[model samples]
Target: MRNAMTGLALLLALLLASGGAAGAADFPLAGTWTLTAADRITPAGVREPDYGAAPKGRLIVDATGRYSLQIFKSERTGFASGDKKRGTPQEYADAALGSSTHYGTIAIDAAAHQLVFRIEGASFKNWEGTTQRRAYDLKGDRLSYRVPTAPDGNVPVSEWRRER
Candidate 1:
């Protein structure tokens, strides 16, 4: 009887340990990722090319439910005036069109494979304090998501790879 009880206790301990480790492995959304590609798809299902040939971006999501993302076209021309405040109107417009940034809290619904971003602020004032939901997939180190159609009716899909 004593030997049987000892064996059962050992088995129970091993099972509990394995279950805890599995739970940790299931939550893979916490980490820093860099954007590798971004494409726009029209409502009619036409897929456009990426934002630029060498687009650059970074995305960071903390374990504590916070995230920030910044993406910009590579090789933006510097202001000819050599002063940020003195840039020409054309330069300002070009800058705005080439880059976007936003920061906010994030929530992951693992069961649903969805991510929710509650924007606290953004470079574009119109997006301040808005909540967005995206269907996300994470495979190995690659993460991708399909953003809902924007207010302008343009759908954007972005892909990121984990930064080692």
Candidate 2:
């Protein structure tokens, strides 16, 4: 009985020391972050990495609760001489890497633990209708989120590492 009580006390102490009964603060995401990953997920539960060739980017969040992103992609065009240089799956994915600039805002509902990301640009937009809003989760240096697939019943979940 004493051992069990001691173990339970330790567990409670650990939980309290780590910040008790509190959700992740919305203030935790207010900073500049580099794009460490970009993935395309399928409805069949497969995750394929889509960003390569140093897909660099920045996310800036201001004090008044406003944010914007300026991201860049290195142009990768393989030599064409019947060599099939840029025609492979990896090659094609690399070739499509180009400058994709987008700007957006981040909003979170403390009650629901949901993050709403609204992003827009000149040409493309996610099927979220206007802006790309998603429910997000943050753990240490990692951030993950899920955006519901277009008109379809699928969803894409992506994980990203924080840039130091």
Candidate 3:
């Protein structure tokens, strides 16, 4: 009986050591996020759809407030391609004719919980070089992000739920 009890106690100790508390959502946003929608707010305050390759890429943010972001912009607009994901030389030529690109940069304000994203490289052609900055909020199992208006009386709002 004494030996059995001792063995049981040792097993319980090992289990407790290995099973720890759940971690905070501190570093989960270190992956690629695709752009679901990009809106072009006309001067009349009416929002329109400006087509481009779906903005897709990865974001690597370190704990020290340094990060790298790579996002693929619209690709199909200026090409006559034989395959998807890669365009033929002619397709490349065509795509360049219209001159469209896609990219995103991100900086986080942990104290204020705001996310500053500077987008350029062809995505801002419609916005006339204005880098849109938005408020970012994150809670347990919930993420909320908002973009303020362009002062032209039109604003775009975006929300992202945890992927998993």
Top TM-score model: 1
Tens-digit per-residue lDDT, 62-116, candidate 1: 6556789998877566799988899988888768877878999888777888888
lDDT of 3 by residue, 1-164 (tens): 99999999998887567543233224545443444544545668676643343544344444332445333345545434545468876666545533334345556767767776556444336643446556766665444465676566655433334344
TM-score of candidate 3 versus the correct structure, residues matched by position: 0.39
Each model's TM-score? 0.78, 0.55, 0.39
State the C-alpha lDDT per candidate. Answer: 0.82, 0.60, 0.51
lDDT value for model 1: 0.82
Model 1 weakest lDDT span, ten residues long: 18-27
- Candidate that beats the other on TM-score, 1 or 3, i.e. the better one: 1
Estimate the overall C-alpha local distance difference test score of candidate 3.
0.51
* Residue 78 in model 2: lDDT: 62
Candidates sorted by TM-score, best first: 1, 2, 3
lDDT score of residue 98 within candidate 2: 46
